[model samples]
Target: MTERARLAVVGAGPAGLAAAIAASARGVHVTVIDSGADAGGQFYRQPADDLGARRPQALHHQWHTWERLRDGLRAHIAAGRITHLRDHHVWLVQRHLNGFTVHALLGPEQERPAEVLADAVLLATGGHEKVLPFPGWTLPGVVTAGGAQAMLKGALVLPGRIAVVAGTGPLLLPVATGLAAAGLEVAALVESADPKAFLRHGRAFAAQPAKLAEGAQYAAALLRHRVRTYARHTVVEAHGGTAHGGTADGDTAHGGEVRGGQARGGEVRGGERLEAVTVAALDADGRVRPGTERRIACDTLAVGHGMLPHTDLAETLGCRLDGLDVRVDDEQRTDVAGVWAAGETTGIGGAALSLAEGHIAGRSIAARLAGTEPDPRGWAAAARSRTRLRRFFAAVDAAYAPPARWTELITDETVVCRCEEVTGGAIREAVDELGAGDVRTVKLLTRAGMGWCQGRMCAAAVAGLAGCALAPSRRPFARPVPLGVLARAGEATGEPEDD
Candidate 1:
């Protein structure tokens, strides 16, 4: 905090770690900041010490790669070239005449606003799960696919005795397979991608039969575990039970939900416990193909549509965006001077691509600092392994790109905004009756995006439901700031605020 660091990397994930090492090796004084206490990002979540997990590597893939990164970080940290700060939740980044200042909230109380000054910055903030809303989705037993995996890997706990993994993307296979491996009775693996899409990209898939074979291994595990697989299907509704806290069961193929009732105004009607679910096949529009509805008896449902980049800091710095991702040239340099981005924030490549991009960006930044030409020989070699993988990912994204007809999935009674308890009907009324065409206008009228999350939860769904463009909003304060802190910083006193 006293002397400004020459290079600052946000996020301790693979990319950030690699970048810090790459820069430090070149003699650039570096500092690494992360929200989690560990160097591994979501990909490498070690169990708590109390758990006594003897072999944490058993729950991870590419374990050797992580070990190398961790060892390198220790060397750099000890050498005095790198300063690693963990549990720092950076909320904003501001440009200064000298370089830039990164602002973050340091602890659970969030009262402490700390600042880090850096001559060059690298943003490797990862991605967050994309949740597509449905009835009973807010129930206690329902969680995201990644969240479920995190629980099994990090806490060594299964979400429920029986689990249903439903969503798009390749993430479902590993999650379901891992749950089954962990002794959970996986009810089903529901995927919305048409199998034919894989065939369409058969050449690319053939080029990397290892990936195909890896997927086959997962399929074999699911089959051995008796976990049913549903293709081109989705969970349209979630029903609890008849009475509050009662058990849930379906009367017919798509009839009943136990502990909770039908999803009404986005709120579950009945109880706290989740007992069953109703799933249906969808046509091209993501609507329930009538007569295809079926019920599955499971205590927990894990569903996630896709992912999006965490681009708040990048956007705040006036970096241009390409489509839904941050735009970066070959070297991963953003338009902003001394600023760079990588990982899912730049695009929706998985951890492997993110690691590669991070290395390239790190080397580029380091070389520039040393007054040498930036060379991408190392990063490009790893990226070459993606000859077939990248194509498959692209196909996967296109096939599952939020069904264009999802607008018809929600009824007026269905709740779209969980925090505000706002229903699909209310959002529709805001557009039709109240003439709320924009996300801000709808937020003002229904308070949909004004909940504890400050719009991260329901903004996209609301925008999609209201037929508005999915755009980001720029705010004065990135996170909740105490009035006292604002006053101490010598900033104007805003009205009363709460987090």
Candidate 2:
């Protein structure tokens, strides 16, 4: 009898979970690693069991799908076909002669090192929010739109009583509606992108009636809560009560016309949290209109500009990237052998796309490991769904893109990199005065991307501010590793034979 081929699936999200289930069912010895304590990723985030709260499914939309995935994972785990390793934060994947070695940090402290050796690796690391900074965004009451949703789903906590959800993405719909449903006062939903753009991709969008219905349900929820929506508008700045050098009052502070008979502008009360946000209308070219500003009083501001695919691990493995996402072939295989990428790492399509891609990859891996060719017909249904979902999301991406001149709203003094406190002025000096033409050069001239986040939060903004195209920064490791882990990698033994 031959030994089963070992597979290491990174991330316990929808993609990773689906891959493990499919592959393991095909007789592969599968191990699933994830940073979260639970199986569900951000999309199916589950509240703590100790919360004693009934009807946790009420917080989620795709209850049936999540249930199936969860049950399948449990069955596989119990049958001894799969091993689940939660709280494993994978930091690096080292290519050996025959296979790969996945090095991860264990637990919340992240000091202990853990390693898993496998014949093949499946990367399902998800995406992160793209945040475009504005003045006063660093205030205490400000949070990412996804961050707000995560808090509500994971901990049942509200960001604040009065919230303003402002962003240019489909994520804003759920965040606003969720907050309103939780009895929080959702002041407004400020969307920078024009809804009219959806007309251009009507054919592609009409192909997915389920997606349209999902969006309509969210719209109805917003209407039920009476959440004021401002399409073709964006938040120019968040005003906190703390005194910074400038006065919060006056037309200049608010930027444009006040709507709904709200106060034009006023001084932020001292020692309080976020008092309000200044939102302005956008022109046809996606530039902000000068005199259409409105001040909406709110205690919290939830903002995000869409998502960026996490390509750090793929880049380290010499995997090709298509635009911002890791590129993979029809079988979900990367250009590099034995490495397959799925989910947001491949592209920012949602959980459904991730699941379909993952299942295809799993079947392909299983067949290839058994020294056989995978018939495309076996996974034709998944492939078809993947195609349709990708097209649907492509339309969504086009319709919800950030405003064209969003950077114009960023004041020279506004801090762009919150990690290193690198301001816009410093970034401009690196480009204008120091001849730093690209994001890398700008990073060298001013320690902007050298912060704790390693440029994850600021890379897009830096590229835009420097007038350069965004490119992947090939990292040696996906996350920061302890010096001990680095030293130990050299001393490890067991060199497997070449494939």
Number of the top candidate by TM-score?
A: 2
Off by over 4 Å in 2: 1-5, 242-272, 494-499
Candidate 1 regions off by >4 Å? 1-3, 242-271, 383-392, 475-478, 488-499
Query: Model 2's lDDT to the true fold?
Result: 0.84
- Give me the overall lDDT of model 1: 0.76
Tens digits of per-residue lDDT, candidate 2, 236-257, equal: 9899775432223211101111
For all predicted structures, in order, the TM-scores are: 0.88, 0.92
lDDT of each: 0.76, 0.84
Best by lDDT: 2
Worst 10 residues of 1 by lDDT: 250-259
C-alpha lDDT (0 to 100) for residue 92 of candidate 1: 67
